[model samples]
Target: MRIYVNEIKITDDSIKCYTEESTEGLQEAGQMLVDSDNYSFAYILDNGQSYSYLIFVQETWSMLHENKGKKIIINDNLELEQFESEFNYILDNIQGNLNYGKEFVSVVEDTFELE
Candidate 1:
């Protein structure tokens, strides 16, 4: 599966994920990823101003996973078409609920300087 972070796309190569059949299973998978130190996960979040591309790498997953439903703001945007394509791809490939409301891919928002 793929995820859009602003204009950038991230795929499975850079991340390790688990697809579960139920929300409970999904939560368990997320918890497993969070407890481990060798995996990372990505999510897309919007906080009014822009969408945030957040990633949890190595040991960082635990902290983020603790506040599961909270919104953390990061500056980013994504193309609707690309996001949809990736979303569909995940549904097609994974045999589960797969609708955790987060993208399977991850990207960092670009920083710009005003002239």
Candidate 2:
């Protein structure tokens, strides 16, 4: 298992959500979580001492396979750095950020795909 600094190991099957100060939109999205499927999520608070990265499992809830999807890391103040920092993780794959943001920006894309 590839464990991150906070003991968090991410995978393709894993979708990540993030929240930070002044980010009312993601703050609200981060509020809702899984209640009950074929998906699992992990919440990792910032550890200013290290780098960070997040994801929503490309198209797990709102993203498809083409769209960049919503940024896994929404907060601006957060300075997370992943070893693999070239890829952009997203909330969806093909889901347009404008479309999803228009009506459900504050709503988490992957809400209940929990394992």
Candidate 3:
């Protein structure tokens, strides 16, 4: 399917929500956050190393699939090059990034259908 960076915003009521950035300003439509049974993520350690992790949410929590998902990576010890490499790899192979740096964040669009 298609993937795009769904920007996160703080609502007036003090809640986090996702919005698409556009010329017309923020269109804070409802987001789809899914708790997938088959998903993988990575964690960057303090020593500049990253370890990948996988999670299975089961079909019971699968209803969350209708909302946006967010993943944030933070590590001051990691170099920009290493961070960028990992970030790009995740975006291209898995999802796309909303922000990148020592604190790389991505809002994934999980549209892949598993038959």
Candidate 4:
């Protein structure tokens, strides 16, 4: 799966994002990557400006599991040809939050535990 950050194209090599098929058949949200990895998700959000995320959680309540390779989510749902337009207006709004963000870092340091 491919996620676009502005003109920068981020592929599956760095991080993997995906959804799990829930028992109820609804797609549950989750991501899979190294526990110590730092991931940056640009929140202006597009199916363009959006920051697609990945995490490996031990808890099933969150619906994220790390398992066999191809089955794991690299990118899903966000890459629709129909939604493939540039996120022009959304990108404009990002400057406001990042400027005043005392807590929010551009590249976020998110560490997960095995539990």
Query: What is the per-residue lDDT of model 1 for residues 30-114, given as tens digits with 9 covering 90 to 100?
Result: 1111111223444443444444333445343333333323333222212222332332343233322223322221111011111
Estimate every model's Cα lDDT from 0 to 1: 0.28, 0.30, 0.27, 0.26
List runs of model 2 lying over 4 Å from the truth: 1-38, 46-60, 68-72, 83-115
Query: What TM-score should be assigned to candidate 4?
Result: 0.22
Per-residue lDDT of candidate 2, residues 28-104 (tens digit): 22221221231323233334443222333323443322223323433433332331122223333213455434334
Whole-model lDDT, model 2: 0.30
| Ten contiguous residues with the weakest lDDT in model 3 | 21-30
> Model 3: clashing residue pairs?
32-66, 32-67, 32-68, 33-64, 33-66, 33-67, 33-68, 34-64, 34-65
Better of 1 and 3 by TM-score: 1
Candidate 2, TM-score vs. the true structure?
0.23
Q: Which residue pairs in candidate 4 have backbone atoms (N, alpha carbon, C) closer than 3 angstroms, thus clashing? A: 31-54, 31-55, 45-49, 45-50, 46-50
* Full candidate order by lDDT, most accurate first: 2, 1, 3, 4
Candidate 1 C-alpha error for residue 14, in Å: 26
